[model samples]
Target: MGKNTWIALFAVVSTLGACAQNDIRPTVRISPPIAPESTAMAEATVTMPPSGYLDYCMRNPAECPSSARDATHPEPMTPLRWAELDRVNTMVNASVRYVTDASLYSRQEYWTYPNGRGDCEDYVLAKRKMLLDRGWRAETLLIGVALDLEGLRHAVLIAATDKGDFVLDNQLEQVVAWQETGYTWEKRQTAANPNIWVALTGDAAAPEPFEAPATQPILVANAHGAESKPEVGTAAPAHTIRQDAEHAESTPALFASTTDAILTIPTPKPRPLLTARPVSADTFSLSYTTETPVIDTAERGGAINGAS
Candidate 1:
C-alpha cells in the first residue's frame, strides 16, 4: 500500500475512534411476524450503540480494494458498495409483512384490507411500490411470478442493487436469494406498468422484443413524478370494457395511493344521466358490492335481528 492507501486507512480509523463497546445497550426482543393477528413464533431485538454506525466505518475501509487499478476498476462493483446494498436489502425485507393471508383472494386486486387475506401477488406488488419510493430504478425492478417450493403461486420483487440481484419477498423479512426464495420462474414484468408486463410465457429474455432500443428521450419529471399534475376528475380515459382472466401465476399485492395522482376519486356529486357501459380489460374496475341488512342497530349499542 502507498500514501493514498495510508490516507484511506487513517480516515477509516478516525471514523471508528468513537465507537466504545461499553456504550452499547442490550438488544430488544421482538417476536416473529404473524398475520394481522395471531400467535407469535420467534423473537429478536436491536439495541442502541454509542456512535451507532461508527464501528462499521472502521470495519469497512474507505479505500478501494488493493486489487483495483483505479476508482472504477471493478466492472460491476467495488467490494464496499456491494456489501452496503446487500445489508440494506436484507434489513428492509427482514420481516415479511402483509395485511392478510394469500389464498382467500384470487387476484392481486381482489380483497380490501382485512385480517389475513390476499394472495401472493398482492405481497410482491406492495413491497415493490415501497422500494420504488426509496429511489430504486423503475426499469431495473422486475416482479417475478412463480411457484415456490411448496408448489403454490408466489410473487417476489427482483431488485438489481449494487450487490447484484437482491430479492425483497413476503415469505421472510430478510432479503434472500432469488433461488433460495424457492420461486420457480414463471413471468417477469416491468414494475411501474402492468399493461406491458406479461410476455409470451417462455420466450428469450430481451428487455424489449427483437427490436432496437428506442431513441426517445425519457423525461425524469413525467417519468418518475418529478412535477405534480394539478388537474383531475377526467384524466383516465373513460372506456367500458373488462377482462375475466385469472391465470395461476404469482403477482404482488397491487394498490397505488391515488390521493396525489390525477385519477379521479369518488366525490359527493350526483350521477350524470347517461347510458350504462361495461369497462374494458385495458381499464380497471372500482367495483363494490353491498348485501341486504342482516341485523339492525339502533343508536344505542343494541342489535336486533328478525328471528333473534
Candidate 2:
C-alpha cells in the first residue's frame, strides 16, 4: 500500500477511538420519582411535651425509657404485626368507658390505663401499654396529639412502620393511616427518643394545655314518688346507650360513684377483632369496615381519648 494511504488509514483509526471514548449517544436524563422518597412523616422543631405528660412519666418510668438517642427504627410491617395492631386497638377501644377526668377522678386531666371505666386519655394509655407488652418497639409506638375535626385536642397512638404511620384510635374501630384520621397532627414522640417529642407543626412551641368541660352531677329521674337505686351490676337504660352500626344495644354496666353520686354510667363492651385476611406473609388487608366513623374527637387535649 502507498505510504500516504497508510497515513490516512491511521488518522481514521485515531478518530474512531476518540469517538468510542466520548460515548456519542444522546444524554437522556431520567425524570425524578413522583412518589415520595419516604413514607415517614416529616418531623419539625423539637418542642415541649404535653401537659400531664411529665406527671405521667413520673408515675410510669418504663414507658419513657430513652431520652438521649434514637433507640430503634420504625417497625417493618407484616401480616402478623398488622393483626397485633388491630387487636390491641380494637380491644382497648371496646373495653374502656369514656368519662371526663372531672366525672371520674374529679380532675381536669388524668393519665392512666382504663380498668373498667375511664376517659379518652386512659384509653390511649391502655393501648400503648398493651402494644409495648406485646414486644413492640417503644420508639416506633409513638404518642400523637392533634386537633380533631371539631378543633378539640385528641390523642392517638401512632405506629411508625416501614409502610407508613398508622393510628390506633379509641373513637374509631378501624386502624387507619395517620393522614386519613382527619386530625391536624401537632406533635409526636420522636423515633430516635421515646421521651423527647418533636412538633409536626412548623412551630416549636407546645400547644395549650387542655381543660375538661365542667360536668354537673348526674341525677336519676323516677316516675313514681319513691326513690330508686341502681342494682349493683345492671346496665344503663337503652336510650342513654350509644347504638353501634348494627343498632344493637351493647354497653357497659352502669355503676354509681361514691364521690360524685352519678348513676348513669355506660360501660364498654369488648369489641370484636378487625377482619385480618392475610394477602401474603408480609402484606395484609387491615381494612375492617366501610361504615367506620371518620370523625375523631379532638376534645380536651393530648392524652385524652376521642369520646370525652
Candidate 3:
C-alpha cells in the first residue's frame, strides 16, 4: 500500500513584511489534490512583456535586462522565431507525457519524481523557462489565471504582448486569444518565489464537478425487444478551441469517454463541439455546449467546496 504522507500546517505565509511580525501562519493541509494547469503559444518577442506580467518579473534580477528603456530586447527576433520556439516546445509536451501521476506542486516547484516528469503545474514551468530563454519578455509574461463561482484552482499564462492579452493553458497547445478562452476570468498573478499561485478567490469555489455537456436522450432497445425510447440521458463531448493565445481550463467532461466496451454517439439534435487545439507544450482546449437552457434547482441548497 502506498504510504499516506500528510502534514497539517496551521500557518499562512502570505504576509510579506508581516512574515516578520505577527507570524501567524495558516494551518494548511499537506495532501493537495491534482492541480488544474496550462501553456502558451507561437506569438513571440515577449519583449516589453504584455501588460500586468511583471509579477513574474525575472527569475534572477541580474540576468534580466534592467529597465524597459532598452525594452526592445524582449521582442521576438523574427516572425520565424516563433516557429523555432514551437519546435523547442517538444520538451514541455514530452515532460507532460513523462509523468502521468499527479504530483504535489505547482509550476517549477512541483516534484518530477525518480527522474520522470509530470503533474499539471510542472508543465507550465517547463514552458515558461523555455520561452524566457528564447527571449520572451520576463516581466510581460506570467502564469495568469482566475477561478470561477466554483472554487477550482485553475491556472493560465497571462501573456502581456504587444498584440493584447493572451491565455496559455495545459489543456491545449494553441495559443488562445484571451477573450476566447470562454471562462469568466479575473486578472491574477503567479506566486513564483517558492513557486505557487496565490488564490484569487479567498475561499470560494466555482461549483462542484465542472460543468459537463448537456445530455440528449439516448435511444436504447428495451428488454421486450420492441423499439422504445429509454430515457437514456447521455452527455455530449466537451468542446475545444485553439483560438487565441491562452491556455484553457479543462474539465474531464471535455474529453470523450475512453471506455473500450462502449460505443457512444451524439444525439440527433447536435450542438457545436469546438475542435481541440494545442498551445505551447502542455495545453489544449475544446469548447463544449452546456445545457443551453439553464437548469432549475430545489429549495433545499447544495454543497460546495474548494478544488485545490
Q: Best candidate, TM-score-wise?
A: 2
Q: CA lDDT of each candidate? A: 0.29, 0.47, 0.31
- Please, what are the lDDT tens digits per residue for candidate 2 over residues 1-308? 11111111100000000000111123243322221122456677665455445334323333443223333456777777788887887777666666666666555555556657665556676777778778887777788777766566777788877777777776666677776666777787776655456778523222221121122112111111111222333333321211122311122333211121111232232111122112322222222221211212112111212111
TM-scores, all candidates, are 0.36, 0.52, 0.34
Count clashing pairs, candidate 2.
8
Model 3, position 45, has a per-residue lDDT of: 16
- Taking all chains together, the TM-score of candidate 3 against the true structure is 0.34
Model 3, runs deviating above 4 Å:
1-78, 84-91, 98-116, 148-151, 190-308
lDDT (tens digit, per residue) of candidate 1 on 76-112: 3334433433444444334333432323432123312
Candidate 3 local lDDT, 1-308, one digit each (tens): 12222222222211111001111123242311221122222221111121112211111112222212221222332444445344434445444453332232322222111123443334554566567666775654555444422333344555544434454555544444555555444334331211212333322232121122243211111112122211225433421111111211121332222222122232344332211122222222222232221111111111011101
| Model 3 lDDT at residue 20 | 11
- Show pairs that collide, candidate 2: 70-192, 120-305, 121-303, 121-305, 152-298, 152-299, 153-298, 252-267
